[model samples]
Target: MTDTSIPRADESLDDEATTPVAVDEEIEEETDVDAEEANGAGREKKSPADSELFRQSEIAADYVEGLLDILDYDGDIDELVSAGRPVVEVVGGRLQSLVGQRGATLEALQELTRLAVFRQTGTPSRLLLDVGGYRATRRKELAAVARNAVEKVKEYGEAVRLDPMSAFERKCVHDVVNAIAGVESESEGVEPNRRIVVRPVD
Candidate 1:
């Protein structure tokens, strides 16, 4: 998450860019992930301590570890800073239940982990939680989907509606399409059913 280049043509959501994924009901309270950055919106902020973010990731990782223990699941946890945000990734076998369908369980668990961090730090965080490499794999799939949608829009000059996706998935599509020229994308509808429409830019 080093703010890597996001130029188009064979690029992906992993191009070192972070998009605010749509918040599930569980994270509505934490939807304002920008609050920390916004605190210094009009002023130069002193470079934040990297340890703070790392500590946040550590706390989240520990919380996740404890959760795995309760569930009797096995996984290896890695906590690190990516693009200046705390990220906790869990990798292991037979962890599909933790990821749930389309990552709904993962999202809820993320909120819980965040709550744990807030309880410990007294500060709201923008930490990201990934389980079973779901997000990474989803990003690649969405990138392909985005590229295909853009190709259609460029060739036909029409808007294409994609299947409904979670906020995280939608943001992945948007990031891919937004990096390309001659096409643009937007989300329509509401939670759980919201989808993306890619259109040719006139």
Candidate 2:
């Protein structure tokens, strides 16, 4: 899932690098989707009616609940809108399997749920799926990583590059870096290998 607090814009090359992110504060690995394509930005994303948005959330909730039933997993599903995006959160115990390693499984499930919504609505959705508070917890972890990168940049006065992260994670890091003074962040490389580089402002 995309961090609603972070402002997303297209990045440029041959210029001061910047972080450009597209899509949900989701719970993994890259889907090989470019920031633009991943976030459904540019020509792809059209704002749907509010009613449609809610409908998408309901569809996603039904889809997720069905999956849970198949897996014999017990969870309470809550569907709602936040930051103008449809969100489905499943809360319960023994849900770590749904989260997977580093939220990989959760991301996959989210895509499937979105597909379910699209199948019925005939429109792509930005529905976010969060299981067991994974999104919030991951966001905090990402924020800490960003703060650490900023500290290193300040101490060494050299660009500090972080390991590759999903588009959503990169955006979370960007949000933290942008909020701090004296340092900046930009994303480089490609999906599955794309990483953020924190630098000290001159």
Candidate 3:
């Protein structure tokens, strides 16, 4: 999950460093509206996509803040709008454990945060959550892996099976293959252990 609370393009690093967001009213209002539309069941919730995006960031920020406080980690939470999306970034010392090896911890955290957003909004959120810039780094690596798979498929004329990855990672690979010519990708198996298969375009 990439950071749902990303800073706007013009927001400087200094602003991010100094600003502190506690409960965004815009988000609370949007979530309240969604809750009303959900009708106590998982029914339709009419809300602007952007508002849903904001709620995701707000929920994620709350989750991360609680985690930091419990673990006794010191990091300032910076929330802002970036690239037409909300993003929350945590920067501080001794925080690498939150990222975990291969970003397993970060992925878990994202799922939990998403659940939190769903519970509050009564509707699923499309929020991208990121911590320690792990997703950004992983994206570059996944793109490379996708290209390599495509090359192998072209050279050997056989499908390529990639190691199981989280849903976000699979989506990245799928997106890469989907954008390329003469290749295709699809996910197979159950999640937390799902895999991706790349094949030649028919």
Candidate 4:
């Protein structure tokens, strides 16, 4: 049977890091209101959408399971809804191949899993897939990269442009830069070549 229980291993990584504090408060209040509405509407039962999201997660988990089996990989898959999105995490050793270099393969697999969910649900899914905590680890590393760029910009009083990065990586850097004082970041160039330029605040 599929393990639908959320693992505590993933909870330590906060998604709120990307969101501004004020916006996070607003989102929390909205979430509270939504929860109240859901509870009242369902009389303690889950709403249809909540049930559908769980189904999507299940489908995603199964699809990933099949892939792992075909690849002869060993891992434990956990599915859960987090931050209003379905997430599937595969935790195990030797999963670096799934993560690929800089998560390129992981991104591809996520897209495929999302497609599988959409095929079953007839609706596009925003499912997130992580292999061996690669994304969580990468997020921490990217934060440091952002901070280093910020330091350079602050010291030289000139913009520091970083190498091209995927959208997810760029967002990680952007969040870190946004949180720090006296520095700002913006994306320039096109896909596969798009990059972030960190500069001192005006």
Best by TM-score: 1
Give the TM-score (vs. native) of candidate 4. 0.75
RMSD (CA, Å), candidate 1 to true, equals 12.5
lDDT by residue (tens digit), candidate 3, 1-202: 4333422346443433322221122221111223334443422342476566666677778777877877899988865434444557787778888888877787666556655555565555445566766677787798899999999999999999999987667766777888899999887877557789999988
Q: What TM-score number comes out for model 2?
A: 0.74
For every candidate in turn, the CA RMSD to the true structure comes to: 12.5, 11.5, 14.1, 11.0
Error of 2 at 149 (Å): 0.7
TM-score of each: 0.75, 0.74, 0.70, 0.75
Clashes of 4: 0
lDDT of candidates 1 onward, in order: 0.74, 0.72, 0.66, 0.73
Q: Candidate 4 — what's its lDDT?
A: 0.73
Q: What is the lDDT of residue 172 in candidate 3?
A: 68
Give candidate 4's error at residue 112 in angstroms.
0.8
Model 1 agreement with the true structure over 2-23: per-residue lDDT tens digits = 2112123454433223223335
Error of 3 at 52 (Å): 4.6
- Once superposed on the true structure, which residue ranges of model 1 sit more than 4 Å away at CA? 1-48
Clashes of each: 1, 5, 13, 0
State how far residue 141 of model 2 sits from its true place (Å).
1.1
